[model samples]
Target: MTTPAVLLLIPASSYRTHDFLEAAHALDLEVQVGTDQSQVLAEVVPDRTLVLDFFEAEIALAAIAELHSRHPLSVVLGVDDESVELAAQANQRLRIPHNSPTSVSLTRDKFWMRQCLAKAGLASPGFQRFSVASDPETLRDSIRYPCVLKPTFLAASQGVIRADAPGEFNTAFRSLQELLADPELQKRGGERAKWVLVEDYLPGLEVSLEGVLTDGCLQTLALFDKPDPLTGPTFAETLYVAPSRLPETVQQCVRKAVEQTAQALGLTTGPVHAEARVHQGKVWMLECAARTIGGLCSRMLAFSGGMSLEALILRHALGRDIQTAQTISNACGALMLPVPKDGTLHTIAGWDTVREISGVEAAVQSLPNGTAVRTLPHDARYLGFVLVREKTPAAVETTLREAWTQLQVEID
Candidate 1:
């Protein structure tokens, strides 16, 4: 019998690559990274690394098919949103346990996801899609106030803006259009980058869910209560503290909505990361992805017997029984440090002091000193992340906030 080998789809610029690789190493699984970045080593190490056009499914499929024949991949794991659609397609063709291409594609498009949710009788916001090239002046009259205009395919809230009035709507729309016209974005998303989705903003407390599906059944692993109100002019998520402080009933409702959402999208297997808002006791589904939480956020989820979220995901994909995988006792949180401005990251200070804070587990500066950083509505990369654990959820959030204050990041 062959040892289970994974084709890990990691984008060239992804922040979570090292964590995923570390998890794979811990499990002693064979990994062949599939990335869009050109590899000079490809000729010498064809089996270890493969280049892929993540946006082009057919081309990616052809490349993956040839690789699979020689090294039989048991799991096609995607590390971020950019690679999910192709991962679904590759896994389908490889006869591996995976979500359908159609399902994964739906999760990628904001408009398609809203349509699916509304069709399934779930709470959904009124939305409309417009071409980025369209006249925002003419379309501004039809848009509802306090609506969000976002690039349909972009994640981590890039190119997402909130418009409250006619002037704000026009300004926000035009600004986002210019951003969507970026050549790099055009190459990555093509026409998916050429349109915008304007949806009536759902005002409420936001939450995130991390879970995995088994044969179409949803097994929720964590429900993170986002202490910060995401009433966004730009929604850069700040903190996610799990074992939620929400009422047990509200937590259950969030879980149920996510379960219904996974079923509605036809996602039967693999990790599912979902976002939602709770307003007046009604759970409104904001977004759901056919992958685990992004960035260092997954570190907050640790299971019994020293199992990480990535390990649980791998075990499930390998067809191993994970009934013993229960979350460790204690509340944990992650503070995703968003880039403050556009400049060279000159100096990052106080990391050592942050580590000394109570309940602080890890404080990472993912970017090097000279790397450029930009804020949201244009750039999607986070500056770094701070992870914490405590005896209670409130304490976790408190520790995260204090740890954040001690750090002094200067982008010159």
Candidate 2:
């Protein structure tokens, strides 16, 4: 039998590469990591890591095809949003099971996901796609208030704003229009980059789900409850506690809506990360991505036999017969420490001390001190993530909060 070899499409900035590499090592698979920038070690070990153009799929596929001809790959996995689309195309080219490129495209565009959900009678809000060049004065009177304006392609809540009145809406529109006009964004040259989606704001607490799809069948892995209120002019998501405090009935509704949403998007296989809002016992789908949870947040989950979330995803990508991925009994959670203010971070105190706090598994600082950073509606990266596990959801939340209070940061 040939040793299983896999190709992992990883964005250069993704924090998940280490975890995924460790998982691959644990599974004893021959792993090749492909990123946008050239890796130093790839010069020595050609199969170790190579440069693949994520923005240019044709060039990437051509390179992957040539590599595949030399060394047959068993599966292709993607770690972040940008890589997932490439992964789908590579899987299709390599004759490995994967989600349709069309479905993955729908997931990337926020408005497209809304249209699919609404057409399927799933929980979706009213939405419209508008070009940034269009004048907002013409549509202001006609458009509804209490709606959200967001970039179709941007994630991590960047350029997502809620406006409760016409004044607020106009303000948000102008702000977002300026953001969209940035040459860096315009250079991307896609409908998603040029346009923004305005949609009715779903009221209530927001939550997120992580699951995997097998031949179109959805099996939920974790349901995270966002304790912080997401209703905002700028959403700064900070924490996620799992084994949600919501009733089982409510969780079931969320699961059903997510499953239907995935089916509606025509996603057949691989990991699914979904966000939704719950109001008066009804669930409203926010957005779904054909990838696992982003950032180091996946560290919050613990599966049977201490399997990391990355391991589970990699195994599923390899077509292992994993019917169930039951997590351990303990409740788990993570805090994505949000950058407090707009300035250069000079120092972060108590981070080491917080790491020693019981139940705090990892306290990592993503950006180096003295690095300039901005708050939401502008920046997408988190300061870092602190993960924990406890006996109950409440305990998990408490541990996270207690650990959070210890961190004192200075910026100027």
Candidate 3:
């Protein structure tokens, strides 16, 4: 059989995509990169490399269709959430294998996700959607105090805020509305002025599960324990430790919840990122996406044990064999570059000192110096990340704390 060429839709500079492409070449798969245009045939070029951006739906669909109509390959795949929908649309039109379109919509829409979970007997936080928050009185009655308000569609913790009381809710609502109306945000998606989700703030130990699903059956891959205290108004994820220290039963319960959610969402193929709260021995599903974890910050499975989640998902989406691709290993954790204050990043101190910590395997500063950063509801900036491999969880925690202390972020 001839080798199948794969097209990856991502920004050209994507470090994550580069990692996957390297792995694919090692497996003897050819790659092609382009904007989603239907005329770009992969089958014609047995060996090619292309990375396309499919953030815009119409353009992406046209490109994929153009390619499929000509190349007619064994597989076509996309990793971005925006492109996931496009892929599903193309799959139905092209008769290619992919996650169902219905599932994509449900998972991408945080509002719909809550409903789906509640209907399936899975625990979901109480939520309310606002096309207009005209009355503070009625809105206050609907949501529990100390709630979270955020855009229903955007990620990277953009537009997410906590409202501790009625007064805070009104202020946050207007502030978010204005932010959405800003020139840049308006260009991104704010012009539509769509609905926002206000939900009961969940206070518990937060953990994230990364999994792979094939033909709708889930194989639990990795569990990450959130090292930062997330019980608050601003849920900033600072640290992630894989192979969670949770007991066996709790782990099993979390896994079961994730699998059931996958089935409900019809996430049959590809990687799924699920966030849940382990509160009082009960696992509550908070959010899930049909894409791999973002920011390349949490490398629990791939960078952790050498099992490339991105590669496995791409191969699986294209209908390739992936059983041999996944492998688990020692506990892996990532600490997002700590945000010391809201200001421009002048310099980071104690880089050499953190390197001296025993478990730290890799440390890199992700942000450029002189970049102005601020606190969210607007800012989600980190200086760098520290990836560590340690013999025990305690050792890992101690090492992270020691490293965290030694490092100084000068935000002025």
RMSD after CA superposition, every candidate: 1.9, 1.7, 4.0
Candidate 1, 183-208: lDDT as tens digits: 98887777788888999988988899
Sorting all predicted structures by lDDT, with the top scorer first, yields: 1, 2, 3
lDDT of each: 0.87, 0.87, 0.71
- Tens-place lDDT per residue, model 3, 1-412, is 7777666664432335555666567657766654333234344333453334455666666767787666765555556554566667767777777778899878877888888888888887788888743555557666788898887766657678889988888877876776666665454343234677898887788888887788887777778888788765666778788778988899999999899988887778888889999876788888788877766654435533354666666666667676665445466777776565678889888888888788788777778889888766666555688877776666676777778888878878
Question: Candidate 1 versus the native: TM-score?
Answer: 0.96
Worst 10 residues of 2 by lDDT: 38-47
User: Which tens-of-lDDT digit does each residue in 1-412 have in candidate 2?
Assistant: 7889988888777888789988998999998888876664355336577688787889999999988998899988888988888888998998887888899989988988888888898878889888887788777777777899999988889899998887888889899887888876664436678787999888898889999999888899999999988889899899899989998999999999888899999998889999999987789999899998988999888888889889998889888966767998579899998988999998888898998999888899988988999888988888888999889999989999998899888889
Overall local distance difference test of candidate 2: 0.87
Question: Between candidates 1 and 3, which one is better according to lDDT?
Answer: 1
Instruction: Give each model's clash number.
Output: 0, 0, 12
Q: What is the lDDT of residue 165 in candidate 2?
A: 82
Residue 208 of model 1, lDDT score: 90
